[model samples]
Structures are given as structure tokens and as C-alpha cells.
Target: MLIAHRKKRNLWPSEVYRVKFIDEAIITVQSGDGGRGCVSFRREKFIPRGGPDGGDGGKGGDVILEASSQKRTLYFFRYRKDFKAKNGAGGQGKRKAGKHGDDLVLEIPPGTVIGDADTGQVIKDLTKPGEKYIIAKGGRGGRGNARFKTSTNRAPRFAQPGESGEILKLKLELKLLADVGIIGLPNAGKSTLISAISSAHPKTGSYPFTTLVPNLGVVKTDWGEPFVVADIPGLIEGAHKGAGLGIRFLRHIERTRILIHLIDSSSIDPADPLMSYKTINKELEMYNKELAKKSQIVVLNKIDMPDAKKAVDIFQAFAKGIKIILISALTGEGIDNLKSKIVQSLDKLDKLDE
Candidate 1:
């Protein structure tokens, strides 16, 4: 039921396309069946009553899923629900082996996790680019009559049948991979901050829940390394219980190593500036305890507003020990400082891992 809008520019004019962002899909995949073996005997003029000369059957095709960086969403799987590979060819009578069936390779986006549709068990996690996993294996080829040419059964007429292919009902789930994830409530200047630092141009509006889907952007700093960032949807109270869009998009940020907790300075109440901050943290903890324990950088956005300074003072007083960075995403204030801090944090994390 989630709708996403994409703008397409053709040769004539710019047109808007309504595309749905599908993160989960259920599909049925089937591999090819092996070919049958042949049954024949050689009858030549020079040689009388020759042995069996039938050829073996060809192998069936396999169903393979490959991960690629080009794909962003699972939109293609929405229309295509069933996939079937080509069947193998039958054996010949001239002792020639049959050709093997071609493999059906499906290209999917990185960070895709495949699982069993019925059991809900994870099959494989395709996180890196060019990662390949075999979802369904092909059947083995059948033996020919020539293979049965023993001492007693020299002219055996019977041939073995081909094996049946595997069929599976699979589920595909996509999670966006990024180094940092920006999370906050609606209208918290998350879209603005990402636009100011990265090349991603997400749609920004004054209303809440403007970002229907997650947006990814590559942020390059002066340190000569670029990292990816994901802008997740806003979360509200009781989001873990499916109250708002949080339950739908919260999984997208689970893979991120760090998080930027953006809070709107203008919307914060002077009496309780820390209430909004605590609410978002509580939602994260309710959903996943490990996620709430990740490293976070608190940022107070929209500092250029009239009531922003008063709210910032109240929040600073409440969060005395915690480090809070104040920035105006609209006017590019303290943006460079934020970027530098992010790079420094990432470097420190890498060193710690080593």
C-alpha cells in the first residue's frame, strides 16, 4: 500500500511516474528437469549384433540469484511472481552426450536476504556485490542403455528416466546497506541535511511523512573516502507496535554502523525539549535492543528558527554529558563540522574493529 513517485525526463518534457517501492516479495522458482536417456542398439553390416550405443541425457538448468549494485528495489519482482528454467534435451542414439541446459541467473540488489516462504527460515544473505547463491538446483541427467552394457546385459533395451527438478516457494527481502542512517521524527530536517551533504535530492515538504521510502546518498569528505548514508522514514510513538510507518521502514537501518539522531529545534517544546529525543530512542529500544545500543550522534536541526536557541538551551541542560551538535540544514550552518565528525567517528570505528 506504499506509493513512491519518480520523475522521468524524456526527450520532450519531464513526466512523473508513480512507482511502488516493494521491499518484500513472494515468488515460486523451479529448476529445469533432466532429459531422458535413449535406448538403442548398433546394427552394422560388418559387425553383427553390436552392443547398446545410446547416449546419456543432458543435465537440467539451475536457478541462480546474483546480487548486483545496479538494482535499488524489488519492484521488478512485483509483476513477475513465477520463474521456470529451461528443460534439458533428450539423449541421442549415436553415443553422443546431450547438451547441458543454460542456467537462469537473476540479478537482484545488494543487501537482499532470501528465505523460505513457508518456514520463514533464512536461506542466504546476499550482502556484497556480485554474490551468487543457488536457490534451486537442477536435476541430474539419466543414464543411457550403453551404461548398462554388462557381461550379462550386453544388449539391454531399457533406459533410466531423468530426475525431477527442485521447486521452492521463496521470499525475498531487501534492506538498504549504508554506513550511516539518519533517523528522527517527521519534519525533523532529515531530508534537508542529506541534501546539503550528499548528492541525493529527496523530496522535502513541510508536512509529516513526506518521505514514503528510504533514500540513499553517497557522502564524500575531504578525507578522500566516500561513504553511503540512508535517510529513513520518520518514527512516532508506539511505532514498534505498528502505529505508524516505523514498522515498515525500521529494518532498512538495521545494517548501518552508525546513526544520526536529528531533532527539529523549532518543534521542540521549551518546557520539554528532551521529550521528543527520548521518545525516538524508546521506539528504537522497543523494536531492537541492539539497535538502540549503536553509536549515535545527536544533532539539533533548524537552528536558524526564532525559538531554536531557547529550545537548544533547554535540551543542552537536560543532556549535559551527551555531545549534541547544533546545525541549520537549511542555511548550511555547521554542515562541514558535522561531516568532519562523521568521518572521524567512522575512522575510529574501523580502528577498533582491527
Candidate 2:
């Protein structure tokens, strides 16, 4: 006896990747078509003649996008390029209207922005959960012959045709939302600091780009109020011009309430640290000046190194009035002080709202 073999499909990776913001994805959305109207006459043995009894047709389904806080990435729709809704049912005789088509609901990550492929103008920015936006409206149903029956025209020969469904080429972009964003070059100890403060475990390595996807950590201050922090991927030179992974993840920092720029003090050339800082700032200004205007904090990492001791002093002298801190993520040096300062800043912002 011959046995049929069952094939196993590779499951999608649950492991998150540190994705840059500049990638482009195309999605084709089609609304359901309206059902056709039915033309039928009602006749009974008792009643010889009955007025026009054709029922009206049902409306087509619509395409809707809903924001979900639980979803952190748009990877769900990455493979599925096509999205469609169900069509409405047709009408029947004796003034019975057909059922309307079911609406298609798409759950997307918070901070998702929808835009038209042609114009590139943003349609909706989904900032809050449960927020919904209609990208494509369903077509209207056609009227039946019964609707056309009037005093002047008693008998209508034909019924109106259904309207055409809407078709749109759409694009969705996701930007992470957090109270604070940590940015720096790869291996700058961003992952270490986040791991020290929160439960999020971002991949850490001696090599570059160990943390592929943005990592969110919940930092609870002394008062026990928790705030969110996001670690953006490493950005290299020419990131504003789409060089490397720089362009892909810059937008993720756009919605941050505050920016914490981490710098590595232990480097081959001491001046290279400051230069990297300036390069990242320049790239931020080039991409969006408003990003440069957001609140900023400068941190010098790997201060436990003997060579980094004097470098921190020199860096502080050049930092001028900007708030700067020396921290050793591996040793947990100055981690509490940094957390306190972050809480102070967040507290001030909250008080302002009150």
C-alpha cells in the first residue's frame, strides 16, 4: 500500500527584528461589489394583480483598518498583499431586501500611518488603540423596481444596476510610540542599559546590529509609576539619505517624548565619539528638524574602562550646558541616578498636563 506524505510548512518566526522605518510595502484593497437587484412580481389566487414587489439590493462591504495596542509590528500583513471584504446579497421579491456584506476589519499596530501609493500623502495616523479608519468605502446598492413605482409611472420595466466597488492601492507605515527613545551607534550599550532597567531582553552581542528590531522597556521610577522606553537600532553615516539601516528606523524615534543619545567613551579615537554624536544629530535634523527639537539627554557609556575615565571628563567639558551622564551598563554604575533623572523629566511632563 502506498501512503501519502504530509508536508509541513515552515512557521513564521516569532522572534522580532529591529526593522528600519524606510521600507515600502504595497497593499491592494478591494471593497465588495453591491448585489444586483431582483425583479419579480407577486401574485396570489385571491389577489389577481399586485403592485411592483421587487425588493432593494444590499450594499457592498467596506475595508476598515483598526489600531491594536497589542500588535507591535506590521509583519502580520507582510506576506498577504491582497485584502477584500464579503459582497452583499441580492434582493428578493415581496419587498425583501438582501443582507449587507460583512465589513473587513484589519488589526494594525499602534502608530501605524496609512497613505496613498500615488500621492504619498498620509491618510491616517493610528496613535491610540481601538482607533479605526475607513480606507475604502463599499459601493451603494441599486434600487429595486418597487422604489420606482409612483403615481405617474405605475409599472416600471427595469431596475437600477448596482454601483461598482472601490479599489485602492494603499501603503502602511509603522512608527513606534514611547515616552523615551534611546539612540546610538551599534555596540553603544543601548541594549545593556534597557535590560538593566526593564524586563525586555534585547539581543546583545559584541558585534554590531545585534538588536534587529526596536525594543520597548517599562521603567518604573521610585514612585512606582511606569513609563515606556524604546531602543532604536544603530544609525550610521548618511542615514538620512537611506544609507544602511539608518533610514529604515529613523521614523521610529519621531513620536518619542524624549531622546536619550548614548555615546561610547572607549573608542580607538577619542574624537570619534563626539564626531559620531554630531553625525547622528545632523542626520536627525536632516530627516526632521522637529526631531532635533525634542527633549534630549546625552549619556557616556562604558565608563568602567580606565581609558574612559579621563575621556568622560573631557566629554563633559565639551558638552557645555547639555545634561550628560557617565554610566557603565555592565557594572550598573550610575544606573539608578540615570533612572532618577529620567523619572524627573517624565514627572515634569505629566505635571504640565495637569
Candidate 3:
């Protein structure tokens, strides 16, 4: 069963207002109504019997949703619950057509999934930058009296009314789009590793639960290509069942192509070095089997610590067939090699897709 963990809060003062990341939002959207058609007759000094000369009404505006890389969250939608497009202009006399209503283009973060609020059906999954989807379609323009003029009725006086626009109640869910996802237990150096590889500055502390939200960073390699990485909050044994902060952040890493499973080398037990490793994987499997099936790279972090060598050796012995990387995020050791490996894995995945 799914549960909502977010809470509503009032907007703080400018000085104290931090950039709060929101992943979900419920909103109402309405397209503009079509303008009414005109009914008029041509009247001139020389003309004896004037004919119908009314023009057609303009079309209503559509409500469009566009994906953007600049936005990271759905924070803007917290206060703004409704969105409306402009109404079209009415037709004028002398066979003149009315102007079309302007379209409303709302920019949202990439990897946002728009769904119908009532039916819970997914409307669109916007994962690419600059991708656009029309959530609400505008009404069609009305016909003028000139179109009704026929042989029997030479000068028609009536005009067709414009159609009504579409209205929709939508649910926007944002899943962070990252090439790599860093997952591990609490205080396992996930935040430290992201800070070392990319420009993101996630808060790090000695205690657990330091990271409340997922942090994204863009890692630029020497090969000139940059890939995005996300540092997800730690998971516990019963994380799939809403234990700890796991459920709140697990969805953020769903879009990642690769997973970097980081382990604390210093805290690993020699008797059961793979205990934490197995527990984390079990949680992933319980939450989503596909998430557990994704390609993963096991990494032992905090190798700079004095007693880490013994634990690392024990873990290596148990994980004999699995490939592992040893790194010290605080000392910046093995980060370059880690970046190279990530790039190579990404390249292989891209080739397979092609």
C-alpha cells in the first residue's frame, strides 16, 4: 500500500526560506473557452440587399505542460493549485475572424509523470528535456453567419456557438532523472561521495538520517560527457514498509540506469561483512523487483580509516565473484577511477539500448 509522507507548511520569510524539494502535487487545469461567433449583415450605400458578413470566432487556448531541466522539484505548485488559459476573442463584423487565444505553457521538471486524478491513470511521462504534452485541449471556434448563407436563405442571421474547453484534474509526480543512483545504509558516505564527484552540496553528518531528500549532481568526465547522479537517503531493513525515511526517497531513484551501492568499510563486521549489503538488497526487492534487477556496482567507502583494511578484506572474501571498488570519499581517493568505471558502464548500457 502507498502512503503520503509530505506535510503542508506555510511559506517562510525570504531570509529563512530554503529550497524545499517536493516530488508530488495535485492541481486543477482548465483550457480557455471559445469565443462566440458574430451575426451581422453587410450594409453599404450602393448595396440594395446586404448579405450575411459575420466572421468566425477564434479558437480557445490549450493548456500545455513542458519539461525543463532547470526545475528540480514541484515546489511551485504548492501554493498555486489552479491553472487557466486565456479565452479567445469574439468575431467582428465585415467578415473578420477573431484572434486565437494564447496557449498556457507550464514548465515542469524532467521525469515528471502526469496522471488523471480521478482515475489514477498516467497521462504522460515527461523524461526528456524540452518535451511538451497538452494536458487540456481548447474548444473549437464557432461558425459565422456567412457559412450558413445558402440558396434558400440568401442572408442567414444565425451563427453557431463555440464549443466548451476541456477541464482536467491532474496529479504530478516527479521522479528524479539520473544516470547513476547512490544507495546505501545510513551514514555510509553516499552524500560525501556525491559531493566529491559533482558540484552538489548535500548535508553530511556523523549521525544517521542526515539526508532528508535526494540530491542530484552532474558529474563531468574528462571525456567531455556529463552524467547526472542522485544521492538517495539511506534505507533500513523494513524500508519497503515505510520504515525510516526509505519510502519517501525510494521513488526518487527509480529512473536511474545504474546503482552505486556504497558500504561503510570501517563499520563492516568481519563475521558478517555482507549483512548490511544483503539487508539493503532485500529491501529493494521487496519495494520493487525491477529496482533490485538493475545493474549495480558495489563500493566500499571510508577506506582511509585505520581499521577499514580488515573489514574490506573480509567483505572481498565473501563477495569473491562480485566486482567491488574501494574508495575514500573524504580523502578523494579512487574517485577518478570510480568516475571512469561509471562512464564505461553508461557507455555499455547506451550501446545495448541502441
Candidate 4:
């Protein structure tokens, strides 16, 4: 029920992809095969009949996934679906052991969760910057015939063969890792607010679906404390049911600690401001009840309009008990006040977590 971003790639302001949460991806990984054992018999002039001498086989390679903070998308995995590792070498005579195989390393963005595609069980969650997880283990090497030679059997003939490596079909899904998520309907000034507060430049217009993907920014308050903010694409009615561009982006909001719901004050349906507010909340509840319960701040944007008072009155009457702030992203009016409230809210949330 999800819709892929249909906007032409060139139409996007930045060619750099801003994919935040990837719902599904399939990966086929193959470990290297174990090497074969050698077979030989010692025949010397001094010793009439010497014992058998067979070398052991080497182990197969492993496949690994490392969590990296540099990567932000799973798009790289889309093209290369197959992953393979090297095989170990066989052992030689004189009880020499075989060489072990090399391991293959894959780097993924932080907050990525790995799951088995077939079984649907959660394998690992990559939350830290440099966390490492082994997706598939390598095969064990075979024992040499010399190891089998004992007091009872001085001339062992056969050596054990190496075990085969593991093969897995895995799926990688990404969850948005930001501290805060900005949500609102199209043209509600979500992008403008982010641009005003941080350095992220998302395409802005009066049209809907201007943003097809999530955008991230680092906002530093006057106190010099920095917090990560994500601008998720707009959500419309029935977004939880996969009605608009919002359904594809709703998952990204799951990782955020707070939600800032923005509303356009200049909207014609003076009551449209509050309607937009309730519709987003309904969609959130439909998709995830816990997401709807998260801490939220209702923001009435573009307050520089002449009819701003009407929007504020309607929102205040309908959405009571919810903290609401009025601001103009263009003129930067009341931006500092908004920042203060956000900082205070974050401080409280952090303390509660502690």
C-alpha cells in the first residue's frame, strides 16, 4: 500500500538521496566452501611400510555486517544482492595446518535492524556508531590423518573433510535515528521551519508533496546545545492506511523522541489549522498507537498572516491541554521563543529517561 517517490530525480533540489527509513530489502549472502583434505602415504627406504600422512582441509570464509555512522541509506544494497567470501586452503604434509579463510565486512547505518527474511525474527539492532554483528559464520576445518594416528592405530588412512559454510537470506530495515521529527500537512511550513532553524535545504513550494523523502538537520540553540531534527514529508488524511505520500514516511517518525506538528495559519479553512492537527494525530494512531502517545508540540506557522488570530483561536479552543506556539518561519518571528520551549521539553524528556 506504499507509494514510491514518483518525482523525477532531477527535480529534487539535491541529487544526494535523503532516504531515511527503508521498510524492506532482500540480501543473499554466501560463505566460501571448505577446502578438501590431502591423501598420501610415507614410503621410505629405511622404513619398509611407513604410516599414512594426509593433511587437513581449511575453513570457509565468514560474512559480517558492521554498523557505521557515515552511511545513511540502504540504497547501496539494492544493486548488489549477492555477497560471497573466500575459501580456505588445504593443509600440507608434515602435520602442517590449512590456512583459514578471510571474512567479508559490510557497513550499515546506525539504527538499522537486521531480520531473517524467511523467519521474520529480529536478528540484531545496529544502534551504536561502530557496533559489529556477524550475520553468517564460516565452516570449520577438517582434521588431518596424522591427528587420527594413535597407539591402537599407528597408520590412519583417511582424513575428515571440512564442513560447508552457512548461507542466509537476510532483510535490512532502517529506522529514522533523529532525536526530533517535524510533522504536518503539505504547505504547512515544515520545510521552512527546518531551513530557518538548521542548515538542511529541502525544496519548498506552495504545492503538495514537495518533499518526497525525509531531510535531517542539526539545530543548535543559543545555549550551544545541538539536537538532531528530521523533517519528514507531509501527511494527509488516511495516511496510516497508505493514502498519500505520508504512509511511506510514517515509520521514520518512530525513532524520534519528540514530534513538532506544524500548521499553516494562513490557510483558508480557518478551522483547517485544527483539522490538519487532528488528522495527523489520527493517522499516527492508526499506524502506531505508541507514536501518537509520544510528546508533541503544536506549532502554528506563518503567523505573519492577517488572519493569524482566527487560526490561533480555533486551535486553542479545539486542541486544549496541548502546548501550542505561534511563529513565522519567513520573518523569524517568535523563533527564539520556540527554541526555548523545545530545549525545555528536551531537557524534561532526558531527565525522565534518566
Candidate 5:
């Protein structure tokens, strides 16, 4: 059982590591049922032949799903799968209508795709903040004896019963929505770079974690809108073949407009500096041709290490057509320049799109 802490503020990148990262879930939901109507008649002393005065039944409550920006995962539905709205109150005597049932609202993270569990069809795509949709509507209230009373039959004996609510099985899948995605092989300084760029504080080691989850961060700018960046983890030699949780991480970056291909200078081989780069790109092309065609910003990190400059020079010589940025992420050398370049690239893409 995965427990999700739905906090008041947005989750910092550090908390993501401690908590289990869940992107998919299945649950059941139900709407409220209508209340039954009451049966009564006017039996006053002055009115010997009083007409029927029964009240109408109240309407049932609806089950609503609301998208919230505060949430980042479908962990809310981990434990409590079943949800039901309040049933409407029954109608009372003396033409008193019953109380309406309350609405049930469920908050989910933005970029969540809702699907019908039984039919396997997409129900709705909640990509924007505060987006809402009525997954199931409550049943209508039944009529009362007074409403059924006619000229010939002044006193109806019985009242109508309440209607049943709707029942549905739902499937939820979450995809990260970010303007920029950082991709690289293990120990490519991705975690360190993301931590430097954003508020993410992922574990930085010599490729320690067996399953490193993706970390998301927001880069605030002095000008223009704030853009989101995600550190996509788990891309290996055979990522397209679902090697080592690679496919899962690959899909997360599909929505990104630009990709930051971070390369470790120390890991580069002077004989074949482009080996790693070509391997990663080949995997991307195999998985999805469009992913390979997406815009990329090649960055060479860890220039402070020994032989790093030599390897970078070799890569620069071989990869003449492409431009690359050299930086030492630990020493913060050329970080600001890298950020400006990212912003510039994004701005250019935006202009071309316009």
C-alpha cells in the first residue's frame, strides 16, 4: 500500500525521492442515490376533504473529478479506491422537499489521463489546472404522491422511490508536463545539473540508485514565464526493448519541447567520443522516430576532472556540425551561460512555432 501525502504546498524535488513514485492507478467510484418521497394527506379539522399535500423527493449528489496543480501523483487513490457521494434526503410531509445530496470532488494532478477501465477508452484528459469533469451523475429524485395526484384521484396512496446512482471503474495515468527534459546515461551529472538548475536534490552518486525516479523542478526567470524542467532517469543501451525501466522514463519526456542531453566528460572515450551519444540517440529513434527528431541541447559536464578536456576536445573535433557547451557542474563554471543558452533555445523554438 503506497501512502501519498497531499500537502498544501507544491512538493519540492527532495520529497519525491523519499516517497514512492506512482504514475498509474485504478479505482472505483459511485454517485449518490436520490431520496424517497413521503406520502401524506391534509387532515385538518376545518378541511374535512383535504387534498394530498405530500412533498417531493430531493435530488441525488453527483461525483465530480477536479484537476489540481497542488497534486503531482495519483497516490491519493492508492489506499481509498472506492468513493461515494451523499444520498439526497427523503421528502417530508406538508410539502417539504428533502435536502439535496452533497457533491463528491476528487483532486488529481495536472497532466493526468482519465480512462474507462471496462471499455479502455479515454474519458478525459486533464492537462490544465482547475479542470473539472463530472465522471458520474447522481440519479434523479422520484416524484411524490401529491405530484401524482389528479382530479379524479385526489389522495394518492403511495410515494415514488429514489433512483439508483451510477457506478464506474476508472483508470488513471500521469505524465510529466515540462518544457525541458534532461536526458543522459547513468552518472552523466544529470542529478547534479538538475539540482543546480532547480530545487531538486536527488541523490548524486557514481550511478548508485538501481531505479532512479525522475525529478521535476521549476526554473524562475527574471523575465518571461517560468518554465518547468524534468530530470528523466533510466536510459540505457537497450531502452526501447524495456531494459531496466527505460521505457517508462522515455514516455515521460515525450511531451517535452526540448531535451537537454547531458554528457559526462570523464566518461567520454577519446577513441570514440560520440559512442555514447549515438547509442542514446539510436535508442530514441528506435522507440519513437519523432523523439529522435526533437530539438536537443548537447552539454558536456565535469570539465574539472582529469582527461575530461582531452575527451571533450576529441568529441568537439568529431562532432563538428553540432554545437556543445563545456562546464564543470560541481564548480558552477559556465552554469549561468548554460542556463542562458537553454532559455535562448526555448525562445527560438517559441518564435519558430509562432
Candidate 6:
């Protein structure tokens, strides 16, 4: 029950090859072929009786996938859809065995899920860094002609051919790992708020959807441990149904323990103060119930605006019992208080889990 992203190129007609590839990459991995066996005869001047002196072929290389913390997205695999390992060397004469091929290690971001492209089967889930999984095993080497030398048949002339390598079509999906996820409609100042609270320096513009990719930042508090936060792409009405950025990037926040529901006070409707808030929650529920169930810190942003006070008052009047924080990301108002609240909420969740 997975949906493809709205924005994608028609790389392949099959669903296995359909990925916008920003967060997902569909590619092929090929292992090396085994080397051919060698055939030779030992003719020593000093020794009269010299038997066959052939050697066995080398084994092919394997295709390995490694999890790394350095990569944040699947961007590197956009143009590169195919990966290949080294081929083993051929066997040498005088009973010398051939050299083995090197393994190909592809590094992917942590929390990446590997799946088979053709069957859509789960291969492995790499959650921690430095994890590795070998998908394709190398072919076995062929035996030399010396092995055929027996009492009845002596000095065999032929050798075995190399075995072919394996080829597989695989798909990769990256899910961001963060303590908190910032969710709201477009132009709700999510990027700005994250920048103000954390070390992340994302581009801030007045236009909507300016922040295309998700931004991760680490918030260090004086009293508690540092927590990671992500500024997800904006969500509008019908987002779950592929409207706007849609559910394409929503999967990135699946691991987040809490959500920061931000809203722009100036954009609040006087007739319906909770329209935007309700819309975002509805989209979350439609996309995933767990997302809606996550604890949220409702924040009203852009309080420095002239009409923000009246709009905030209207929203608070309608939203009874819901504690809301007011902040102006541009002026850095109530940002510290908001950060403190986030730490407190995270600590409470940890205690409950324990």
C-alpha cells in the first residue's frame, strides 16, 4: 500500500523503476565473474617424470551494501543506476591459484531500506551506521585440467570456463532519523523556526515551498541532551492525495518521536481560525495515523506582524485548552521558550517509554 511520488521521470514502464529518486533510488548491482582455469604441463630438464601442473580458477567478487551516516539523501545514485564489482584473475601455470576479485561496497544513509526491484521483497533494513549486507554472492571458480589426470587418462588438455556473475535490480528508500519533525502548511515559517533554534542555516524566503528538501539540525540545550530536528516540506490540503509536495516526503518523518505544528498567525482566517490547523491534522491522519497521534507543540509564528495579535487572539479563543506558543522567527521572539518546551516534551516521552 505504497504510493509513488508525483514528481518523477518515466525511467522505466514498470513500477520497480519508478522513483523521483530524491529519497528513493532504483538501480542494478552486478557481481564479478569467476576466472577461467589454466592448462599446462611441467617439463623440467633435470626431472624426467613431470605430471600436469595446472591450477584452479579464482572466485568472483560479491556486491555489498553498507550503511553510512555521511549520506543524507539518495542524490548520488540519480545518474548512476548500475554498480559493478571486479573480475577475478585467470589461473596461472605451475599449480598457482588465481587471485580473488574485490568486493563492491555501496554506501547508503542510515535508516535506508533495501528491497528487490522485481518482486518488491524486503532485502534488509539498515538502521544503524556502519551496517553492511551482502546481496549477491560471487560465482564459484572452475577446476583445472590437472584434476582429470588419472590412471586411465593422463595429461588432460582442456580447462573449465569461468562462471558468470549475478545481476540484481534493487530499490533503496531513505527515512530520516530525528527526534522531532516540524510540520505545517506552506509559508508557516518551519524553515525559519528551525534555523532560529538549531545550527541549520537553510535558505529563507517569503515564497511558499522555498525549502524543497528536508533540513536536519541539532538543538543543544543547557540542561538536557541535544536533540535532532527536521524541517519537512510544506503540506497543504489534499497533501495525502498527491497535492502540493504530497506524501512523497512524509515518510521521512515516520521515525520522529514528536511533531512541531507551526502556523503563521498573519495567515489565520478570522472566520475560521483553526482552518489551517485542522487541515494539516486531517492530512496527517489520512497519510498515517501514527503521524497524527504524535505529540505536537502548537506554535503561532510571525507575531511581529501588525495584525498578528488579533489573529492569535482569535485562534486562542477558538482553540480551548490547547497551549500555544507565539514566536517571530525573523525577530527571534519566544524562540528560547519554545526550545525549552521541546526539551521538556522529549524528556517526558522518554520517561514514559522507560
- Highest-lDDT candidate: 3
What digit string (tens of lDDT, one per residue) describes model 4 on residues 119-165?
Answer: 98999998887899878887777877877889998887778787788
lDDT of 4 at 126: 84
Superposition TM-score, candidate 1 onto the true structure: 0.53
Each model's total of backbone clashes: 0, 9, 0, 1, 0, 0
Most accurate candidate by TM-score: 3
Give the TM-scores of the predictions, in the order they appear: 0.53, 0.52, 0.55, 0.54, 0.53, 0.53
Mark the regions of model 1 whose C-alpha exceeds 4 Å error after superposition: 1-176
Give the per-residue lDDT digits (tens) of candidate 6, residues 1-354: 012332432333544422222266899999988888889788799977688878878888999998875555565787799998887777778988788889899988878899998899989999877899888877766677777699977888888877978999999987535789999998999999989987677777787776666777767677555667888789999999988773677887888889999999999999999999999999999999998999999999999999899999999999999999999988999998898999899889877865
Model 2, CA-based lDDT:
0.76
Model 6 poorest 10 in a row by lDDT: 1-10
Per-residue lDDT of model 1, residues 223-342, tens digit only: 745667888778999999987675677787897879999999888887777888999999999999989999999999999999788889988998889999999999999999999989
Cα deviation of 25 in candidate 3 (Å)? 25
Report residue 341 deviation for candidate 4 (angstroms): 1.3
What overall lDDT, based on C-alpha atoms, would model 3 receive against the true structure?
0.85
- Clashing residue pairs in candidate 3 are none
| Model 5 residue-pair collision total | 0
Ranking of all predicted structures according to lDDT, beginning with the best and ending with the worst:
3, 6, 1, 5, 4, 2
For model 1, which pairs clash?
Answer: none
* Window of ten residues with lowest summed lDDT in model 1: 12-21
Error of 2 at 316 (Å): 1.6
lDDT of each: 0.83, 0.76, 0.85, 0.79, 0.80, 0.83
Per-residue error for 287 in candidate 5, Å, reads 0.8
